[model samples]
Target: MTAPDSSAPLGVFDSGVGGLTVVRALRELLPDESIIYLGDTARVPYGSKSPDTIRRFSVEDTQFLVGHGVKAVIVACNTATAHALPLLQSTFRVPVIGVLEPGVEATLSDPNCERVGIIGTAGTIRSSAYQYALAMRKPGLQIHAIPTPLLVPFVEEGWTDHPALESVLHEYLTPLLDKGVDTLVLGCTHYPLLVPLLKKMLGDQLRLVDSASTCAAHVKTLLEAQNLLRLPGEKPTLDIYLTDLAEQAEALAKRFLGSTFNKVKKATL
Candidate 1:
């Protein structure tokens, strides 16, 4: 049942549809919460942009969602989380969560882990975002970074497995393996789709961190603490928005949300 007088939906934004993985987790875990997801599809990959550019894009995205009566916003893009999380939290009135902090928290809390590696787009690798977060939590942490640009494109094309995909993963992961890191953080939301290929390459010894799931757990806690938890009744209504409307977003919605989505509202921000 809808919460009496509930006035807004939960807002989520990513540079593109990759963040739908986070949306999928949210819908399965909190079925009653309404969600408004905005994908900056026109500028699909924020991973190569400068921090200034990412922050500006994130701010514009947040403003668009906030205008639509969002109770909270999730910065589902890793690049945005790295660059714009603090800005979003301070600028917005409602609770704002990002994928970075939660992933860092989870990795640090795992006592079995020693050295950690991060694979992301060039921008994320250049920012040293994951390295800094991990270091901040556990001082003297060994960190390695590999900028895996091709993985994002493969994900965009929905090609998780192809002869080309394996070639790309091998080429990208070579440096991280040389660094001998034990835990690999799937820094891009789209990266979850590549877990099987990554596992085959890295073997069972190296753990791949699913930042989206960690972020979802964090959202659950943050909402509860703020008295914003959605009460259960019927399934949640999730609305997807994209700067460039695409059939792909609509097709992928069910995989992420665990239910068929009828509405994918288009937007430009």
Candidate 2:
């Protein structure tokens, strides 16, 4: 493995377009750093796949990014991180970070945080990664986790404001609300897109811990510590790649990335 250079782009990948939220956060927090994002649209939603399959897919994804000579790789997919982070870190020479630990740390940062609610894909919840991490940090803390499999599709459909979405959200959040959870962890990257609606529905008392922003902050700290931060004043670029581009890929990318959206190239992995 070659020595990591400060000017090299940061590589990020997910099972699909949701990882763009991480890219969006990175662009805001580390404007001087360039980014290379890979969305495996061809095999989107690794949530339902077996752990072995998820690990294999994640290896290929990391291989593709490492081949591009990135300074570090960020596993922006919650499912991928839950299942394959250790393997990827061992296999790759560059620094490998995941979205899970940062979010967990952020969630527990508040001393008053007692009751917590977590919502993510079925696979992420089933893996118990977040639950385990949180419990390990704060013993006897009250934690409630729900598998919000339906929320992802609604978010992708751009129906955050739809009246029907309110009902769906209500159904998913009632258990947590009943348990009196004060902090809510948005476990999936796609969940950040619904923050506005979530705030309006859940109100101000419930603190929302967005994994995307927390992960970006963590990335910045790590890069700084390793002396790999790109120098300031140099215009940074964001290159996007996808294993397969669906018809709605561009539109969905725009939704997740907002103004940071760029033309995506096809990645043969």
Which candidate leads the pack in lDDT?
2
TM-score of each: 0.91, 0.98
Per-candidate RMSD, Å: 3.0, 1.0
lDDT score, residue 158, model 2? 93
lDDT of each: 0.82, 0.94
lDDT of 2 by residue, 79-198 (tens): 999999999999889999999999999999999999999999999999999999999999999999999998999989999899898899999999899999999999999999999998
Among residues 3 or more apart in sequence or in different chains, the pairs in candidate 2 whose N, CA or C atoms overlap within 3 Å are none
| Root mean square deviation (Cα) for candidate 2 | 1.0
| Model 2 lDDT on a 0 to 1 scale | 0.94
What's the CA RMSD of model 1 in angstroms? 3.0
Residue 117 error, candidate 2, Å: 0.7
Cα lDDT of model 1 by residue, 1-269, tens digit? 23323446789999888888898878767767888999898886787787898999999999999888888889998889889999988998778899988888887777877888888888777888888878877888898887888887787676777889998887877787787788888888888778777787767868888878888889888887777887776666777888987767776655544467767878976
Error of 2 at 2 (Å): 3.7
